[model samples]
Target chain A: MQGVNLKLDEIRKAVIEMDDVKTAQLVNTALKQGLAPQDILNNCLIPGMKEVGELFTRKEYYVPEVLLASEAFYAGFNIVSPLIKSQSTEKKTKVIIGVVKGDIHDIGKNIVKVLIEASGYDIMDLGKDVSTERFIKAVTIEKPAVLAMSSLMTTTLVHMEEVIKELIKKKMRRNIKVIVGGAPVNEEFANRIGADGYAEDAMQAVKLIKKITIG
Target chain B: MNILTIKKHGTFKVKKSTKLIDCLAKNGIPIIATCGGKGRCGSCRVRIITPQKPPAERETLFIPQSALKQGYRLACQHKITHDMTIDIPRLKKVKFTRLNANYGLALDIGTTVIKGAAVNLKTGSAEKISSVYNLQNSIGGDVLTRVGASIDGKYDILSKLLYSSLKQLKNCLGIQKPAITIIVGNPVMLSFYLHEPVNGFAQYPFTSNLNKGIFLKNPPRYVFPIIGGFVGGDTISGILQSRMHKSGKNSLYIDLGTNGEVVLIRGKNIYAASTAAGPAFEGIGVTCGSLALPGAIDRVSYAKGALRFHTIDNKTPIGLCASGLIDLLSILLERSILKDNGRLKYAVPISSRICISQNDIRKLQLAIGAIHSGIKILLHHAKTAPKNIDEVVITGEFGSRLDVNALVKIGLIPKGTKKVSFNKDLPLQGAVMAIKNNNIFHQVETIREHSIHIDLAAQPNFQEVFVASLKLAPWN
Candidate 1:
């Protein structure tokens, strides 16, 4: 495949115009060449997903736009993922995300998952109503880089510490970077529970994960 | 002389009854009889063992013949003539105390106010209810302001303020301790109550860690399930107490407060969501708009092109009530004093007969538009329309007295929908129910499970409709 100069304007057009086919085609063309997956991801996928996240956060785009952009991002991710050398998997990190037990809310968790995954990270989504033991077991088995716990209830948030404590009990606390998010879990609460970091949003989660790993 | 006995459940003793109505009335019984106990409600019927004179017209008209044959006599009509035994059926003696008792602790955690009541459960009523402005008002008056406050190190203040308010309410009610505490509030309020972070509700996948149930080791040992934020505990309480869930027809329960929560119950399912209608209905931002309290103008009537209003105190003119605000908007629109698009017809020579202003129309438009847009989203999510709606049960202070016709004419509530109404204290009723039976927690969970929560933020057309609705001036 001959190299195509994937300029900023071209990538921005793919995102702003919401042309999934064009975005995927350009990313695939770049990947098929000697261009790095990391470059394509940072220049195209991250920025495109960031636009979707920002538009959603600012109330500019609604659910349909966000959903469509995420799908488009997924199309681009599929193209770049295979070309990334198997050794590059070590460069990326695994993160486990779930809504706490007794909380069946997943919309926020799902959005965060989408944004995080689009950021070139592997996610272990435990889904909603995830018990502390399940989180502990996942921590022990997969040993993900970051354990992202989410909850929508003020009442169910107390369960986050239990999961954190269980991780410590299993001697997996230092090995795992625990990130807590959701409507009720604040930075202070995260600090109180001894979590590694607290991301206010999905985009923030990506930044925090990047800082913890790449730094 | 006839003897009648009033007993609890199964056991009773014979007592001389000279005049049953007088005795029952003196005893503070609430018997439903419109004709002053002339047996209109058949609510005062009692069984008699001794044969008496033929049934009276009042008795025959209201009470069934079968019941009459089974010794049914109107308590008001029955008088002692000879020594006779009277059987007081469970229906007659179903003592209903003032609904204050059951709530024992009624907490109305409004964005601006936190009012509560400590009721007696045994009497199926409310008792010493207390109300106070929420201390969180100091941090911010609205949910967004509060959210901002939460984001900026003011979360503790909200928690402490509400806790202090609840404590004070308990003290005022002389409640030693509320056995089962039920909190009914907006999502923000609920989040603040449990000290959960609420900033997430302001963004995507909006929700908070709302406890489905709590088994507290504290004084109020049993913690009930929280309804949900946005369409939080208050609306959940409204649905439970109003029995809107049980209604056979397609119904909508709109609790118009700072956060207007709309619930559409059809068959076995509930479609619930909330629109940030702001504090317009509660008179927070509206000039001359006040709550449905004493001296507030709650109703408006137009006669001969003149707009007249009826106040809560039945006194001289006060500020406009929530309903009156909507009516005023509707009247302005109808008389061509305001445009259908919610603009004032300033060119027309308007006299003292009626007054309409541009600002008034804008205020009305915002309030009514929020409500209208909310209904549209709810209906759309439910895959139904206003025509499919069999009834609209309007709750809350603003909802109770809303002019249904005006609501339709101004396109607030849809037309042809039968408007069912309830007083502003339905949340109190629900709190009472929750405190009385632990089962209410499970009931709320079931209701929550059956409910389809539609996030207005997620609705693509919400902003478009909201902006479109804002064009209409003060919702008359």
Candidate 2:
């Protein structure tokens, strides 16, 4: 327990350096020593991702780096997830992400999912060609912090409204924050459909989520 | 009596002597009057249970003389007379590739935007797309400007820009080398890519070596031949993918890009024409018009004589682009904010949002007029009318975003037309096909040969139609 701070530093270096095996080891050791899961997430994982996100925003990193870092983050997460659940510690946040219905496009949505998960949030990855009902169901079941919807086609962008309509029908829209992204999507489109937020890029999604949840 | 009412959908007027085609065209009703509304195509024919005038020369030329005697008339050829009813069967809608096997790459070389995509051959679907400003953008924003640049002997820079762009796209896709690549672009894009002089498209004889596909050593792929300078390979690819050839049903495929390409298919006969739609649809040349890029207000409201705009970025006020231009123009027409002369009602005190100037209206008039003239030429040659046009297939990513009702209101698309919107990432789709399917690669050869090329400038009536269509009310 006295070595908690030392383990946290090692966890930070492992995530920053994108060393998944070492990061996972440090995270497991810290959790075994009775360090708070939230502290490890906020102080180590969050800071590490913030640096990675900055690299992405500045174009220092691309889709590959973000994806690899996410893999490392998940490796560490698998070990702590069982402990936190057993101890009944409150989870940070859960999220549902998908490319909207009729839009089978996925590169953009996949990028955003990796970034969000790397930020210490649990993700329900709905994948592409997502139905509105499925989104609503996932939101109700997971009670995620945000619903991130992506669409690359203008013709299919209308389906985003269907997601919201389904949410209103289920009376669960008020309980979840909805953020939309994609090439054709813009803030106007987001506002038009009454989404809580709109991110033009994967990095922007991270920053906006922080603003929304932390605020 | 109910039939006599005409049940006009939007703002079309029917007259006793109004030729069915002219009436439909005037109302902005979408009639795929490819063949320039000529009866020669039989595409403009409508069943007239209602007594109507005898067939015109163009209709008689296409439909058998005996069939014409039986009371069938080209909608462009005959006019409605009595108050009786008639049946206008819906034309078969053009279907695009939906399956992954059909997906292919598409490279759209627009006057303003250079778009690229990766398509699937098995289903003819598209993905892995990217778009950026045509680096030749620095040369000029419109084809005419670029043509002028070519005329000035600065075509090399334009060609270099395009070549590098393709290279950049290839690199981005991680395609070290694709075995086969399909390219769809306007005549300018193709010509520039080939490093050929573009002056032919600017004047008559309007012919180029582009009717046949070409091979480039640099890209090392088979480049699809453009049907014409204006129409380009994108529309050709679209026409081919639409299967307009298979149904033997008279169909017209119009790809409204910087240059508008219109094709007419009647039975096995195919005729293609080009219209200098310019960059009007992209919002260039219009006073307040711009491309549908960021900061452009795509929709505006002038309810109760006040203005509100919804921009693309949802940010602070920005200039209007093509999507916004159509939206604003339609809203203005609906509210009578502009006079019939295409002049803004000056008395209303133009809103700050309406940056549209007197000059901009003239440009819109010219651009719209060019589109109208192209349709008329197709009708004139095909001997068809607007009403006879069964289906109007307008392709383009921009076309999907534009409100059909608004487009017709502003005389962009014909009125009362049933428009089927296809996700037009054609250049990318064509590329994807080129990469995977060897059969499609061969098909491109046949498409080049079978594609009937109509020189818009050489067509005798182009000047007259272009002039006539230039007016605010082209119908009269």
Candidate 2's displacement at residue B83, Å, is 76
TM-score, model 2 to reference: 0.49
On residues A53-150, what C-alpha lDDT tens digit does candidate 1 reach at each position?
Answer: 87656544434456667777877777777766553636567888998876665667888898888776788899877888898888878878888989
Q: Considering every candidate listed, which one attains the maximal lDDT?
A: 1
Tens digits of per-residue lDDT for model 1, B1-476: 23444544232222455566555443333332222342323445567777687888867865556778897887777766655555555232212223333345667687655677666767645766666655454443456555755666767765776677566556666665565666777777777777778877654456677746555557563334555556777777888888878777789888777577888887887888776665667654444556666767777778986667777768554456688777777777788877675546562222222233454455556667778777877777778878888777777676236776777778777767755564677776787777777677777877777888887655656555565554443221
Candidate 2: where is the Cα deviation over 4 Å? A1-215, B1-105, B119-125, B142-156, B171-174, B195-203, B215-220, B301-305, B347-354, B397-400, B471-476
Instruction: Give the C-alpha lDDT of model 1.
Output: 0.67
Q: What is the C-alpha lDDT of each candidate?
A: 0.67, 0.64
- Each candidate: fraction of true contacts kept? 0.00, 0.00
For candidate 2 chain B, the 10 contiguous residues with the lowest summed lDDT are: B92-101
